[model samples]
Target: MFKGLCRLTSVAALVCSTFSTALGAESGKQVYTGTLGKTPIVLEVNADGGGDVGGRYFYQKYRKDLMLSGKKVGQTLVLDEVPLRGDQDAPHPTIRLQPKPDGWSGEWRSPEGKVLKVDLQQANIAPAPAATVPFLTTLRDQSPYEYLRLQGLDLKKGKAETFMGYSLQWWIEPKSETTLFEVVSGYTAAERQRINQQLMGRLWQEVAGKFDCEASAGETFYAQTVEPLWMGPSTISVSIATEYSCGGAYTDENDMPLNLDVKTGKTLTLEDVLWLGQGKPLHYEREYNDATPSSESYDAYSDYRTKTLAPWLVQQLSALYPDEMKTTTEREDGCIYGDEQPWTYPSWYFTKSGIKLVPSFPHISSMCRDTAFSVLPYNLIQQHPGSAALQLP
Candidate 1:
């Protein structure tokens, strides 16, 4: 994605230069970052032939991207804002500014009849580039099910930008029921379209909600999906990773794993694939609801983590990376060498050869970068006590 942005920057620069030289016009694209009133903003101006201007202006406080269009007269440029969703009755906002060698200084008129002064410095940044290639593509009518497609969204305000991105490279199934589609009935073309729209709509709303809140708080939020791992004949797993900053000293990173059963179109929990001791069956919904983390279901997870999963993981890690464990223990005092708090359960995904575990940042060590990952070979897991329940041959 960075490479694509770099390419766009170069192309835009070339086009601007060509217009300036050939047409003898003030034609170029410049990005400015600063604040409008109390809110941060990112404004882009693209001036073309005959002083025709158009670009995008973003409001960080509201996660709104307003279209800019106007004309340059003499040494000053005047641009008006078009709302993201057009409403005919809303008052149109306008900006009048003069270009300086270092940046732009302007006056802004709000839709609510308020006027404010704006001073901005040229932001040495690249615009969020569009996704040109699909992560995976399905031919028309080639398979019984449509391939999972990748999508990207960007919201920029001043120097801050939030990107919601997904990758479909791990979608290798030729034809099978997906968790997103199983809730709806029928597989006709129209039904498939409806299912796809609903699935994508939900994802968009989730990201947009976060973006809107963070914008007002003077922060940025980004979420993306990692490459999926196929666990077995019926299971597919992927991790949704998120980074957020609410004008804090540091950003927070989190990971949520989704282990879906392709056959049943439901998520597979620990109880589904492994026995959880003698008791009534336990089932966990795939979706993670922030509002319900304090509920009974979470308590059940906490118990399972402390008593069963953590111990088993320690044994496996000891056998896999003994030297690293020994060194870590020797470095810290009062930190029980091998017994680290296992609150952040490792998100696991299965491959043909083994099961890969990805623990969120700060789970294993405070300084670990990104996420700590390890793979337990299929043979090794099969040797464990409850391997028979996994249904792997």
Candidate 2:
């Protein structure tokens, strides 16, 4: 289940403020979840003493969050979307919902000028299963030093006939009392929002684009950010991993590491994490296991595999596991040890103690081997050349 926060205004406050004479009530917020024209949605409404209304509307289908603001004019409640940055030119949808005895009914207008009849009944607010609901979890909490939150969104289409799906789980740090912490948190939030838009737009274009595939042959895409790593006073880091299968022979997996300077909101690259000399750092492009001959030459791929990253990684791994490497390398099919194969970017994350490296499946050995993780302690890293640049304690 996804866990996150949904800060809503109390229904009592809304009633008393919007219809004080008709229904006397107290103040606060309420959340309602249901469907809007077959799309699952969540609405949070807040009411103030002056009859001002403000809250959030979550379009679960696309995992879009729209800020809402409106007021009760006579017996009608009107709400409109407050767009985010770079969205000013886009049409702003509006909701004209009227309160009913059991729930609310309204009409929703799309930016494209399409209209949909909305029928929403009040229901108990409960966490939906992640497998089914687009956004199943939300969290809003604070610690002495920092506050943390998470939100999850999933989309599934053509499921009845084929199987196309996309999912995103992310963290949201709305505010922080610390200046540097707040800046870095805002940067991360903005980056996540940008990625969400790109991914969603890509998925739609792929599924409905000119080269659309048959519904019987759909694909699946999934991505999620792991638990964040926040320890040092000046650094914060997280990893986002993705897996996709488009009726291919093998599913593809990749990861993006997000390391940030807590003071400047600047992203830290892999080189920043590792102490590299003036020469180029270890880098290699992957060759898919099911690559076609029209792709780049195999010799170039092999050269990168054996000459660049493989040798360096081998030396490090040997230093860390000398005894195991001696016996393991003697065996046939013994860990391709960096050979021509479908390559995935190694996944890495930072911790207070060390930097952890997660080798993808088949990267260290064969598919039979359990995924292996290697940790280079901070002390070891400090011993490397130019390590002083890291300024680690």
Candidate 3:
């Protein structure tokens, strides 16, 4: 069920107005912190039954902005956005919470309501996420796309830098001299290699070009630290601090794109690169055995619709001919590969299923969409007079 996706799923800012020491702690190894702001594009999920299911993604060039935070360590965050019908606008709740020694307890209320409630603690506070290299600039600034495969990042120098008026440290300082560092001494050779190889990069050229970089610092560095304090079985405490510019591209609410041309047929752009992701894989083992008690089955093909079918078909094609298919990872590689996934429907499936046209990623409604699409392409080619049946193991 969609709820299972929620189960699989699942920060702060300095400010102009500093809070009293009681509300804000700035000294003595204050709990590490992080903040994610101005996530240019808004993600609207329908929350049908699982992750990204039955959701219509409207890539608003510029409309609403997203931000959140929690106090203390080991807290849980539940963000719910229910799309209302027929002029009825649903209210969304932005909750801040931390675990109390007594039990799970935190205050929650809608932005439009005064009816606040204190609920029992169901989970612990989640730690901040890892700080990684910004994708676009990394790709553009790095070596020839052909040689830039994903690999471990070596922290040559580690230190801190004050960015955007905030005094922040660099967890994995780049190999440059101007950076800072505090090497934790206590590990074997294997441990040292593991620490040295901790690297993260993003694919952002498309998004960055669509929206300009907000700063002229040439390049800014950030840091992150994670501590394993259980918020839930998989949850932990995370503290992060990074530099972000307030002057980058902003899309007007009306400027968002309702459609996406993901397949090879359409023109490739930085926007596509920004949110590109491999179609979700239906992990048979996880879905059937490891999923939560209330989890739904992972079926690629059952009921069929173009929306439900396209991504599934593409995923199958990807599995069948992985080296040739376009994936977010490969796209980030920036190499000249063969045809990309066309935004348009391949001819064979449409005729058999008797459907016309399909929406892009966020518009998908069900697993069936992916499943139907997966088999349809191969099925079409197989039916061609002398063609042999395509095999998928």
For TM-score, the strongest prediction is 1
* Candidate 1: tens digits of C-alpha lDDT, residues 40-101: 77676778768888876666444355677889988888888765444745778898888777
Deviation (Å) of 345 in candidate 2: 5.3
Off by over 4 Å in 2: 1-217, 221-225, 279-309, 324-345, 360-373, 385-389
The lowest-lDDT stretch of 10 consecutive residues in candidate 1 is 139-148
| Whole-model lDDT values for every prediction | 0.47, 0.44, 0.26
lDDT of 2 by residue, 1-393 (tens): 111212232221221222212111223555555567778676766777476788666565443356788887776778887764345656688888888875688888877888887776543432322321112121111110000011232132211211112122322222110001112223356553433333322222222211111111334333333334443544555544444444445555555555555444344544456643445443232211122443345555446544554456556766786643444357464654332222223555667667765554542333523334356677776654331144453
Candidate 3 or 1, higher lDDT: 1
Ranking according to TM-score, highest score first: 1, 2, 3
TM-score of each: 0.44, 0.37, 0.18
- Count clashing residue pairs per candidate: 2, 14, 44
Query: RMSD per prediction, one decimal?
Result: 17.4, 18.1, 24.0
Cα deviation in Å at residue 214, candidate 1?
2.8
Model 3 C-alpha lDDT per residue in residues 326-355, reported as the tens digit of each score = 544666543222222333223121122221
